[model samples]
Target: MICLNSLGKRIAYLRKRSNLTQRQLMNILDFENLSRYENDERKPNIDIIVKLSKHFKISTDWILTGQEHKSYRNFQHKIELDDNEKNFIKLFDQLTEFEKGQIIGRMEQLIEMH
Candidate 1:
């Protein structure tokens, strides 16, 4: 079984190493309940585990096991992801289809502006 308390520590460590605060992590994690996860009062489910895994570009097993690994590079192809861009991708993937459309529409508007 994964030690959730230790997992919380790893999460804290990675978040800090990435130079983000708990509130900032909440922006990516997007859960009002995330305080409990950071504090080790509650463990996240596998769904959340996979979400965080992809968000950070780490494996779920590594995250649960608290193993050290390379930090995720915020790029794909020629596009480098700023912190806010990364946060958006992480959160956007979790949204409902309607929410996704709204985001896409906003992105289209942003593209049209430039």
Candidate 2:
């Protein structure tokens, strides 16, 4: 069963694991909403849950129920990045925030053009 209190704890755990303050996570959700969520004052809707899942690179099922869906668990073992992709991630990690944002913006624009 999905428990809102447990869900809040999971969200808080993900945020702390990423070393992000509630304010920093504001890019995905407002501080006030995040604070309330973390305090178990309210539950997030499906859209917010999906956003959190993407932001944390985690399964929404894990966030909601602390269990990995069987299909998602199986999919996790199939991830295999090539050398170029691995190098790109390493290089991207070394970039400044502004540079990373610029790169992401350009990538978005390129995707839109396709």
Candidate 3:
């Protein structure tokens, strides 16, 4: 079974390490929502987990299990992005830092609605 307390601690740790307050994390979650997660009063759904993983640049496995899957670690270097993904990255790279953040915030809002 997953340990909610440990997962909460990890989330808090990542936030602090990134120098982000719970309010600053509103790009991914509301302040109260993030506080509840960090307090272990709630468990985020899979969509939220994926968003958090992308925001933190960590694997979902690491977020949930605190460890990388051995197979993933072994084959990660061989993985390749598809052409559409490559094009998306090219476009994203052209944005200013503030515009990039806005894009991420919009994506997070879209994800949260579903």
**Each prediction's whole-model lDDT (CA):** 0.73, 0.83, 0.81
Question: Considering every candidate listed, which one attains the maximal TM-score?
Answer: 3
Order of quality (lDDT)? 2, 3, 1
Where is model 2 poorest over a 10-residue stretch in terms of lDDT?
26-35
lDDT of 3 by residue, 2-24 (tens): 34347888888888889998888
For every candidate, C-alpha RMSD to the true structure in Å = 9.1, 6.8, 9.2
Clashes of each: 0, 0, 0
Please identify model 2 stretches exceeding 4 Å from their true place.
Answer: 1-5, 28-32, 75-114
What candidate 1 gets wrong by more than 4 Å, as runs, is 1-5, 68-114
CA deviation > 4 Å runs, candidate 3 = 1-5, 28-32, 81-85, 88-114
Task: State the lDDT of candidate 1 residue by residue for 5-73, as single tens digits.
Answer: 477776666667688877787788775566687778899887677767776877776778865444433
lDDT string for model 2 (8-112, tens) is: 899988998899988889765543588898888899887678778867888889889988888878897899999999999989867865798899999999999
Tell me each candidate's TM-score: 0.51, 0.57, 0.64
Best by lDDT: 2
